[model samples]
Target: MGTLGVLGLELVQMDTPPTTAYLQIYTEERCKANCLFCAQAKDSRAGLTHIARGMYIPADLDAVVSRLKMAYEKGYLRRACIQTALYDKWWEDTVYLIKSIREKSDIPVSLSVFPLGDERYEELCRLGVNEIVIPLDACTPGLFDKIKGKSAGGPYAWERHLDGIKRAARFFESVGTHLIIGLGETDEDAVKIIDELHGYNVNTALFSYTYVPGAQLVLETNKEESIRHYRTVQMARYLILEGIVAYLDMRFTDGALCDFGAQRDVILRLIEDGTAFQTSGCPECNRPMANETFSMMYNFPRKLNDKEIASVKKELGLG
Candidate 1:
């Protein structure tokens, strides 16, 4: 795992090591929620150590805290991201980890967890969590219910998650949520929800859905279609966030993004550097290869090269 490599717990090679130390709270029990796509879902048979493409082997808490301090100082990492899964001891584990990290380091911490109460949010803010992410994971309530909400046998509710994100906005300066693409949502659906959240000051991180072996749900998303959809949505997100175009101004035909509704030059100029296609989320969180393969890099960790820029243009129908 990239975090393990940074902590000197393992020898692994990454073309670009994650700028953020991606650590998941270690636990033997499966996550209580049954998000169908997750490897740690309640009824999942997949390895508990796997999250998307990252294999997070458990390590010593004190050692990781020590290395994290070193990594932050040496500029190997700019942030610490702690991922949480629902289980009986999640709160205790999360608190302990945050406290431990705070004890040794002042590096900004990002906590990616599901919806929690204000009491928990206030405590996390007090513990120096710079950002809090409550992942909606789906673009619409129908899709959310089918996969990560109650219909999927999960405890998450769309309304409750939105409330929690809004609640976090009041407590944390940077509030974010995750929305995984390629999960049966239209481009318009993705853009609309993103804009809606943006109206509330919630930043959305985009992820392409991956099929992990032994996971509960097996989906066969069309590769080219998903890529086109993701590229369009990525650029559109940049446009909306930057005020180049509002979601309402965008044209959609049968749920596909037809026109960006911005001047072609404006769009072209923005995409020239390819920050539009980089990983999105809390500041300094470049999740390199977290949901991508070498052949199909959805989110480039660094700046895009000329060839990649050309390819991205073609993918987004810019050229």
Candidate 2:
């Protein structure tokens, strides 16, 4: 069972659930990367089921596919996403899994995997991949190395990931990338990357760094600070993506965002709309509670009501 299944979107049990109809599947193999922030790192003791803040039970692919097919037919499933962990022959396994899912259903597929070259991407496009996610987990090259690259003895490279995202933008219509906040990066660092990726026409999925026990990188948690920073970045990404604001229009002081270069009323109106605070990812993909708890939501899975909007305003220092 996948995380959604465990969260009560059970394919075999639930006839109708009010969750996003996207099915997420992760490769069972252990990842080779030793990223300090990741629970799935090669040296981490965290179990596979606890890697992504959700539990996944190992099950037969055929059975999983049967359930997915049922969900798709019943209008409970809209798309499917396959996430790969780095391992020997992982790419081969990912391709095979994509083929398997395609053979079984006509639902659009999105793949999150290690950076690959042009030929491999072309092959995936031919395989009917609807979109591709190449995650630049850390914003800057220095932070990338320290968090997910050579400083951590990880296989992923900063330049390689960027190049892959650029290539994917050319090949795939909907290219997406992931960014995790509170990874020892300043607000300037985060927004700069968001601006650069926006230039590449790639969608950015912003995530807050959720503390996991026994992780290599031990960091203090500041709820107020984290919420402020995340809300600011989320709003910035949404504004830039929607063409409502540009990176040049954003101003920072001492590496922190101080001004959006837009009128205060205009900014408030945009904030009140509340779409900026929702989960960021592929279209129609909402993994509720994937990063934080319900009361202190890092990414709202649905639109925010008036009360929720007030809560968000308080968090953003607007109320």
Task: Give me the candidate number with maximum TM-score.
Answer: 1
lDDT of 1 by residue, 152-257 (tens): 9999889999999999999999999999999999999999999999999899999989888889778888878989999999999998888778899999999999
lDDT of 2: 0.79
Clashes per candidate, residues 3 or more apart or on different chains: 0, 0
TM-scores of the models, in the order given: 0.98, 0.92
Off by over 4 Å in 1: none
Cα shift from native, residue 269, model 1 (Å): 1.6
TM-score of model number 1: 0.98
lDDT of model 1 at residue 195? 97
Clashing pairs in 2: none
lDDT of 2 by residue, 1-319 (tens): 3335633345543322324433334555667898887777887777675544644555667766666667666766677777777888777777887888788888778888778889999999999899999988898999999988989989888999999999888889999998999887878888889988999899999888876675677678788988889998988888889888888899999888999777888778878999899888888676666676756888887788899888888878888
Report the Cα lDDT for residue 207, model 1: 92
The CA lDDT of each predicted structure is 0.91, 0.79
